[model samples]
Target: MADIFDKKPIAAFGEMAETGARPYYRTAAPDAIMAGCNDYLGLATDPRVVEAAAAALARHGTSCSGSRILNGTLPLHEELEAALADFLGCEAALVTTTGFQANLAVGALLGPGDASFSDMANHASLVDGVLLGQGSRHRYRHGDLDHLERLLAAADPDAGKLVITDGLFSMEGDLCPLPGLRELADRYGARLVVDGAHDIGLLGACGRGVAEHFGAMDAVDLFTGTFSKCFGSLGGLLAGPAGIVEYLRYTARPVLFSAAMSPASAAAALASLEIIRTEPARRERVFDHAERLHNGLRALGFSTGPSVTPVVPVHVGHAVPCLRMWQALHDAGVYTNAVVAPAVPRGRALIRVTPQATHTEEQITRILDAFAACGRRLGLVPERAEHDWTPVALARPKLTP
Candidate 1:
């Protein structure tokens, strides 16, 4: 808990929680038509994933009770890592307690003396990782390869450089230009790191991720992802060449100090990976749902970003109206997230909604219907719920009290 003494506020600060207005929580379905959370492939509720976790609980009790590098290392952990490496087509893979640690480990240990380059809109975990690392870094414009090239060209040629970006922007649902970034990285003598946190089971031809989406297999140098989204698991992974992974497994602070993940989560990860590899139809369904929302919103005259993925954000210009729009949607029995100032810049608040593979066609249609109705009532859509201008966010969300 935070100290009450820290609650000192200036005249500009306003009451959000006290006003009894905020639209964000992780609860079970109130009814069946709910659509907000981003389990894009919707594997979290799969029978196979649930059963695997349950079986692990029965055999291993509840927790591992130690760190993996210490007494917490179990046979199940090794088995899961081996399976993940094969599935991701990486030489080796290291499983961490959560997605946050997975990225942190790499950033802290990988570039001790090298220079780093990151997209301005990369995940917070990735930013934190870079800050904790031994190298200096330059943040390029969001998904702008030209800006990245300019930064790369101006950097020291003798020093090592690594470029990083999110394969899919979580809030905007737009894809990064991987192929173009790869070309720039190679021409400038830099290694590329791609965060596939959202793209793993949602993008790519067979869900192999963005490397496959843009056919940049030869260009990517490092890769990281989470099991919670598509794997229906609750941990993170760092996959790459064998030697680098071994170094992280032994030296990363989060891995060395934190207790290991439970066997239940490990089992769930294994089951989820298997399902993702075997089921291509799940990804297809996710894309189909996204396309429907994109078309429907545009037809209603709502301004959306250039997104080609499952995440769709309906732009709302101010914070107060954004909150009202979120509340109206909730009253209509649909839930979504409200992003306001600082999370987004001033005058660019938005109501971000996501559609998943498990969401039926009727569910998608209902969400669009709610948007049209609530938007009209709120006047967010002057011509029918549409606004212009892109906000500088999609991920790296700050805590909202």
Candidate 2:
């Protein structure tokens, strides 16, 4: 019999890994600078967060060893869920072992004959979640509410409808129009679900997320988030109405069958959540770094699409050039993620960089300087623009559609 594994195509990073070309997987490099990681608040290394994990390891042992529905319901799990619910201003919350699993749980709630409207650029977890439900999926253009409204108008009004989108798009780094989505949901009698994986602890006046940033927190029906990014820990949360959460607690496959989240992860996430609530300076500093980095890149004439948050992308138009650009940046000691198809469309390859609150002025300057050098050498941007490049405004106001 033929081997099944031979049919699987090799991944893009396989070549790099085989050659030991930089050991990007390991973070032990003495001088490596990370501009590509998702640790937005810089709390992953906080002493308090570390201490909390240590305490949990000592107190609860390592693992819950079973699913949450059975022997796995620990006190720490309940405490973290309550904390997440309160932080997101929701009636209840469920903590899962991973953010991907959290999205799957929400997706699994959709039944046959139900309908789901997703953004073209939504995270893969959201896409996979919709597939799990085996419902009709209608994907609208990314961030275009007009397209979504048109699609919704043609769907059967009586069918159960779920509209799914990312609060802050991870790759393009733009905020979704939540108010418009809510208005559409109300008009069509659909439920609005937001995956705030990249938004929570990094947006709004108080970092409540995109819904709060847009003053539509009360309108969103389901809010899903991850602890891996801002919390600097390993877990996921689904916060929403009490009845719905209670329903998913027993129905979602991952929660019903998978092992419970590790004790250390729960404790660390709890500690990080508390810090996010109390320290407004971290959020402020993150935006400060983002503004400086965004402005500096735009000044150099690199196209950064409609980004208002810390996640920034350098739009290089093809795959090979993007990889080349990444290699150049890597060789220069700056670490960034080079994305290509199908993370993005063909010919729309780009480099993604994220800045954290812990990054200093000198660090930001070094990142910019390296980009300027590599960008000029690659001819990705003009050596000097005859006229200054105009900066695109953060986000346009959402009007009634």
Give me the candidate number with maximum lDDT: 2
- lDDT by residue for model 2 (238-289), tens: 9999999999998899778889999999999999999988887888787778
Worst 10 residues of 2 by lDDT: 392-401
Q: How displaced is residue 328 in candidate 2, in Å?
A: 0.8
Identify the leading candidate in terms of TM-score. 2
Location of the lowest summed lDDT over 10 successive residues in candidate 1: 392-401
lDDT of candidate 1 over 61-130, digit per residue (tens) = 7998989988887888999889877867889888889988888886655465688999887888888888
Model 2: residues >4 Å from true position, as ranges? 1-3, 8-28, 392-401
| TM-score to true structure, per model | 0.90, 0.93
Clashing pairs in 2: none
